[model samples]
Target: MNGILLLGGHSDIGGDLLTRLCAGRPVVLAARRAWTLTEVAERATAAGATEVHTLDFEATDLASHRALVDRAADLTGGLGTAIVAFGILGEQRRAETDEAHAVEIATVDYTAQVSMLTILADTMTRGEIIAFSSIAGWRARRANYVYGSTKAGLDAFCQGLADRLHGTPLRLITARPGFVIGSMTEGMDPAPMSVTPAEVADAVATEITDGKGSTTLWIPRRLRLLAWIMAAVPRPIWRKMPR
Candidate 1:
């Protein structure tokens, strides 16, 4: 099994996906810290990855994204499947005070994903591109609209790229999980139908195995319908509403 390459291997969703999907196959994990490599490798090995390797992957480092893709291909021997799951949750007030930090979150949430994924889409031999987007992008709330806008951009890009790869064997699975109970949004209020990283991971695994073509997976799945309603809501009505 030419295993899967997990870009944000340290994330809860990424970890769970590896545990569920990499049984009897090789798995490679990548994150911003090399220090985390060994721990991830060990967990993946224990979870049934025949081999596991890690490398440094900083979302802000766009110039190096192509190199990262090349490295994953070299390590995994043609890349069975790849999941790009990097994200950040920062305070909106702080984002106002520190424009750089807000930009960083936005870049990580959207632009970095675009950079790395474009490279992966070109380099992947025969695998799926599974990305974790967010529902916050739908109706950018005042509280976290900064992060939400970023996801909105990424969500649109993923769909367009999926269409671009239509004739090829490559599949794009864009996962949007609502109010996940996890570290990223520790102090954040839970939205309607909040879920766990495990739940998001479950949807991701199914999207890959199902061989569905270019479909976005909403954790709980029904969120797709809700997204329509959310998008339709007028800005004035949405803005006056409380977060």
Candidate 2:
């Protein structure tokens, strides 16, 4: 089995996906503090992963992305799958007023993903990429548009990348979930049809094993319908929606 590369090893969703998908395969977990993944690496190994390795990954460090991909490929033989899941949701009000904070949010949420995904596409041999997008990007609202905009950009890029990779060895599994109620959203009010990281991971794992094409997975399933409905909503009405 080719090794799996988990780029955002610190995220809850990444960890769940690692445990769920890496059975009988090698896994390379990458994050800012690779040492923090010792527990996750152990769990992955216990869950049937042939071996587990950790590497320091700084998403914002674009200059190092190619090297990171190379290192993972070296350790795993050929990375069978790469999960790009690092992101940050900055305070909406602060982002609205502060240029530096807004740039940070954009860099971390959108720019970093673009940088890493681009490198992975050029480097990976044969496999799939599970990218965790968000339903919030379906239609931006005034309340959290800052974060939503980043996701929207990411969603569009992945959609384009999938089309570009058509008929290729690589498959892009774009997973978009509604407000996730977990450590990441600990203090925020849960949105409608919110999902857990485990749920998202299960959905992703099922989609991959089912041999599905580069289709988007909307968690809770109903979000697919809701996204269409929201798309048709007029901007005036959408702007008035309370967070």
Candidate 3:
């Protein structure tokens, strides 16, 4: 089997997913601070990965994306799976007045994601590419519309990308999870039906192991029902919804 590459090597969900998928395979972890990947790399090694490597990655540097993928492929011989898991849930209040902050969120969450996914899809001939979406994108809320909007755009992009990959050897697994209670959501009140990183990892890993074709998964599965309810909520009330 070819090896696996995780773009956001330090991400909570990405780290967990790697442990689940890395057995007997060469693993590459790419992150901004390659040094920060030590713990995750150790875990992958303990989990039976044949080898673990780290590469410096800067998500906002769009020009470097393809080179990063090429380097990863060289390291692993061939990349069979790629997890595009880098993103930021920018502070909505500050983003309201800070143009730079808002753009940072957009670039990281949406634009950078698009850049990496496209590179992976075009370069890798087969295997899986994992992208993350969120229920916040189901409908933007006033509290976190900036972040929500990014997810909304990303979810739509993933939908189209899935279709484009249909019948091809490459498959995209877009995970639209609800509130994730992790380092990202730290200090915020956990939303109803919140899920943990391990839970999200389990869901995606299961799909990679047992599923076929491009698929979109609602983590916890029942979130699909809630996502439908989210849409039916009137705009007036929806605008009042919490992040």
Using lDDT as the measure, the top candidate is 3
Where does candidate 1 stray beyond 4 Å? Answer: none
Query: For candidate 3, which ten residues in a row score worst on lDDT?
Result: 211-220
Candidate 3 Cα errors over 4 Å, as ranges:
212-214
lDDT of each: 0.81, 0.87, 0.92
Q: Model 1, 1-243: lDDT tens per residue?
A: 266888887788888888888878877788988576777678788888888878888878899988887787787777878888877876778997899989888888888999988988888757688888888877788877888889889989988988887787776778888889888768878778889988988878876777455377777778778879877889888887655
Tens-place lDDT digits, model 2, residues 1-243: 278999888899999988988888988999988888888888898899998999998877889989998998899888889999888888899998998999898998999999988888887757888887899898889998999999999999999988888788887879999989888888888888889889999999888887457468889799888889989988889899866
Question: Against the hidden reference, what TM-scores do the models get?
Answer: 0.93, 0.96, 0.98
Instruction: Give the best candidate by TM-score.
Output: 3
| Top-down lDDT ranking | 3, 2, 1
lDDT (Cα, tens digit) per residue for candidate 3, span 117-213: 9999999999999999999998999999999999999999999999999898888999988899999998999888899999999999999888654
Give the lowest summed-lDDT range of ten residues in model 2: 208-217
Order the numbered candidates by TM-score, best leading: 3, 2, 1
Better of 2 and 3 by lDDT: 3
For candidate 1, give the lDDT of residue 169: 74
